[model samples]
Target: MTFAGSLNPSFYQSLWQDCDSIYMQHQSNCLTLQDNYQVNVNLLLLAIWLDSHHQLLDSSNWQQLQQILLQWEQKLLLPYRKLRRLSKAALEQAEYQQMLDVELMLERKSQAKILRNLKSMALNEVSSTEPESNIGRYLTLFNLDSQDYPNLGQ
Candidate 1:
């Protein structure tokens, strides 16, 4: 088992590349692409869950993960928190804007769901990704958007 919260740059890079590929695959409804998406999610989730429970890494690797996580929390999760703190109407507006962004590159429903979940799971409330911002960075790193999940809302 790896450390509950650490990964080296190489490992993270591989996963990041995998995520990009998955995002591209998701652009269409091809059968091969569909299989790739499932495989990608499974691989990412495994790494995330493992990192959540174990700190499997050397000091240097841990530090690298920390820096990467911090960057993600700042750039992505922080904005998410700010958006979530807004009034309900504002939240809906922000969600709608995201739904319309071309770079979102996901099915309409999938993109909407991710935004909604992010609204509910304020940056501070998501422990699997916060405290040290583990899950938060993973999502950003993997390019997976959340649609305000009530279950994830803290």
Candidate 2:
């Protein structure tokens, strides 16, 4: 499959859906990473998806992806997430839900941006008998280790 097609929002959403239970299982750890380490869950999920699809990116593409995700996280996701969290108790249910819907929309837009940029790049398929772990490389970007985030390694 083409990189863009494979990296669509639905692909990431489906993976997220499938991994929801795992996330919940390690919710505390995930939250700690999010709150303390400023981890972007979507990026982590993207790394997992890329590895599972055997879409090995060269260092340049990987760095570009990280930059794209960082921009999205800094400008959109993090602020909205904080808003949603802080407003949950103060806002009416409907209002909170609306905010959540907006956040989800923003997330999809970020995914689309990533997909569009990746489609433009001349990506190559993995040629080695055993491709390296994209997840490991991604975690290293955050000074994280898969051992600490067991769900990610899985």
Candidate 3:
């Protein structure tokens, strides 16, 4: 499918539906709800990125690109995410509005950093000749396994 096709709401919804099922299965006491939730969202965002750039990727560079993205997520995105969550919680008190505003800026900065890192990634410096395989590879990149979520299409 083209990037435009992938952007369709039904297509995105199916992707999230599958990812959410897998997340719930692995979301146990070992993780907080915030971290657990991020896993799915991050992976979905990664899927969107990969789909948007499918024509420029192939199996050879796909794994490497995922590693780069994962590292960026862990080092840059996750910390700011925690800060954002804290700032959101502080909203209940009303006095922390200014602090939340600062946190929002910091969080957006980290997000931009991650997006910058992503834009630097390339698939062997050439476009993939076979785009069909990109979706299969991208879907399984996070180990969500479409086979495990056969009902998502419904």
| TM-score winner | 2
Score residue 134 of candidate 1 by CA lDDT.
34
Question: Could you report the Cα RMSD, in angstroms, for every candidate shown?
Answer: 15.0, 4.1, 8.8
**lDDT tens per residue, model 2, 20-96:** 55566556766787778776665666666666666665556667787888876788788888889999999999999
**What TM-score does candidate 1 reach?**
0.26
What lDDT tens digits, residue by residue, belong to model 3 across residues 1-154? 2333334345334543454454455445114323543333333344434444444345544465556556766775567556666777556656466555665565445445444444444432224454343445555655544444333222
Q: Which is the better candidate, 2 or 3, if ranked by lDDT?
A: 2
Alpha carbon deviation, residue 27, candidate 3 (Å): 19
Which 10-residue window in model 3 sums to the lowest lDDT?
Answer: 29-38
* Clash number for each model: 26, 0, 0
As a whole number from 0 to 100, the lDDT of residue 104 in candidate 2 is 84
Q: Which sections of candidate 1 miss by over 4 Å?
A: 1-48, 51-55, 87-154
Deviation (Å) of 113 in candidate 1: 22
* True-structure Cα RMSD, model 3: 8.8
Local distance difference test, each candidate: 0.36, 0.68, 0.46
